[model samples]
Target: MNKKLCLGAFMRPISLHTAWWRHPNAAPQANFDFPIIKDLVRKLEDACFDAVFLADHLAVMNMPTNALKRSGTITSFEPLTLLSALAACTTNIGLIATGTTSYEEPYLTARRFASLDHLSSGRAGWNIVTTVNTEAAYNFGLESARLHAERYERAGEFFKVVTGLWDGWADDALLMDKESGIFFDPEKIKPLNHKGKYFSVKGPLNIARPVQGWPVIALAGASDAARQMAAESADLVFGNARTIETARSFYKDVKTRAIAAGRNPDHLKILPANQVYVAATREEAYRKKQVMDDLVHVDSNLPNLSLKLGVDVSGFDLDKPLPDIPETEQSKGHQREWIALAQREGLTVRELAKRAAGSGIGEMIGTPSEVADQMEEWLLTEACDGFMMVFHSAPDGYDDFTSMVVPELQRRGLFRTRYEGGTLRDTIGLPRPDSRVD
Candidate 1:
């Protein structure tokens, strides 16, 4: 009875799996692996996915460079660069990439996406991120990291400016009027002249309004301020929460705010992160996934857990109770959502983390039917518009699901059989915006 939601993959350019290089079938040698990704895009197209989303960070992770490299998830290619290749390879599936608001000026960021939109014939989405790494601060010439709240504030303003700039050039502004010797209608162009708290920019973008009126703006936010930005400005919001109840709460929270802000509640689509695994039987899938989970450093993960929880988990026994760590203004907004799920489900902190991790894929894992049923239930209850599929391991991790599960989804009639049209907006069923100057 509900509009079956769409699907998007959350990916890195090269690797997403730590043991991917060792996956026997994994492609370890080709980090440039554009062909491998082309196959991936084709697979998504086969399954009628709306888009394939790419995530990025601006620096080498602070961990030992070799260790990070061993993880095979070290910085790969720049997202837009790789996605451009994807645009050439696949026809219908949307291409989404992460470009940070913290480190980039809006003009360049806006132009790159607009260009990709054109290249993809409008099949493009932009994942807006205000990154969390400290290393990026130094690389970008800042002496210190801005506080998380401050970063979000800056990010919010940047979104406004970029969207504003996208509108500065009117639909008819660029005409090759050789007879009149005018390349553009100067009257149709306006300078942004924006002087915001964080950024000052001027003038119309060199690129015209993209095919989608602009590429779809996706917000991957888990913090409260971050969620507000998504609700206010995002066409799609990506979240990595662990349970349906938690997902529902988040979905409702955003919709409520969007309504108060005079935006359509339906305009804000909530997509919780779901990591998935599938097989002929649930038990075999479970066993295989546990093996992959074991390769993860259980001990090393505690520190990251601690940082998110705002409590040191180093001393806490995996068998003991998780200490109460009050949520802070600048951190752990996702954990706040996690804690709510734990309380609702009567789960221990360790249990919660394990479920998150053990889902073998973050928040979504199971046999094909089980995973599909859960997804449908979430949709029926209004918990999410769809999932941003985060592959736990690269290549084969996604390959396995596409091979095993996507067809099952097709049989169920919950997903599309083919892409409806060109352009990411058309693929996602969003109407293209009319060219505007206001």
Candidate 2:
């Protein structure tokens, strides 16, 4: 069989580009518009994308008040609710919603995903997150955010309990025998009498077994603990890297860890986030990038950069090189990446902050064919299994990628031209998990 790349569309209510909403053709307030989201989901499905990954946050990410007011960053619909609505309008495209283990109960999380699996006929996926924003703690009535290590520890137990609940009823437990008047085989149902450091539950999941046994688990984190969790439990891993060398290292590390954890490394797909600007020519694409880049305000984004770097770069000269600062305990992965990027590119505080506001992943600026060439190189070089595309603007950017890039990828035999399976797992070539109760 020929090697094919997996593609996922990273969907957000607002544009990832800081100033994208100000673009002339941008749809204002489209995040809350259900009709627009429905159309976008359909477009991705028609393009034969494997999944539409929905990113979520419990609170607005604005730290500096000025940035919050200046940027279009405040509004968003809850992810699960949005995914449920989109599921009704489309089929075959996996609906992956962000659900943080930090703020939710295992039983509710398990039940919600199980229900989504049945509703989508096994196209549901959960993007497990630990909710890193400190502002989110205030919203949840906590004085301070939980320590990073503690959060992951709870997440470990949380994953165990949720999967245990999912296995409560065997796949063959449902009988539906009308003549005998037996709806299910009682012997096939078992309770999860789980007691752990974080959660304790006795459950036989109320819903029937998911069509794919359990919805796919997607994880995104770059720390050692995060990578270990992905190796042990996740079916798909989302990552970010600014260079191919870094991405290749991450790819090898993840696969090696998966092997050490007693799993077939091929079963775990590592997809780094990728941003592209495609037009008829390379000049046009560069012009488009410059247009968006010009709209970013330095003062408004300094706090965000500071947060990522764990130091105040705001006081530094805009044209001067960044001073060496200690790494943040908050997001060490991001700190390391930003520092490396600054050193490699010789970027100043202003230039680095502006770049950060666009896409954390590096950009590909070229025509459809050129962009496709880069994607294929990464896949063939083992830098990544695929990409989680971060669009500059939805619908329009999405349309451009599907119309221009998708066909080019198909021409090169690097992407799927049609749906290959009924469920997300089938399209991605992941095996359907067997029910533990059986």
- Cα lDDT for residue 143, model 1? 72
TM-score of each: 0.90, 0.97
The whole-model lDDT of each prediction reads 0.74, 0.86
Q: For residues 1-438, could you state the per-residue lDDT of candidate 2 as single tens digits?
A: 377899999888456777777777878677788988788888889999999998898887746777777666588788888888888889789999998898899999999999999989889999998876777888998866788899899999999999888888888998999999999999999999998788889988899888888799999888899999999999999988878999999999999999999999989999998888999999998888888777777656687687677677778888888888875547767788888999999999888887777756667889998999899989999999999988887666787789999999999999999997799999999988888886
RMSD of each: 2.8, 1.5
Give residue 300's lDDT in candidate 1 (0 to 100): 33
User: Candidate 1, after superposition: displacement of residue 426 in Å?
Assistant: 1.0
Give the clashing pairs for model 2: none
Worst 10 residues of 2 by lDDT: 325-334
Tell me, by TM-score, which candidate is best. 2
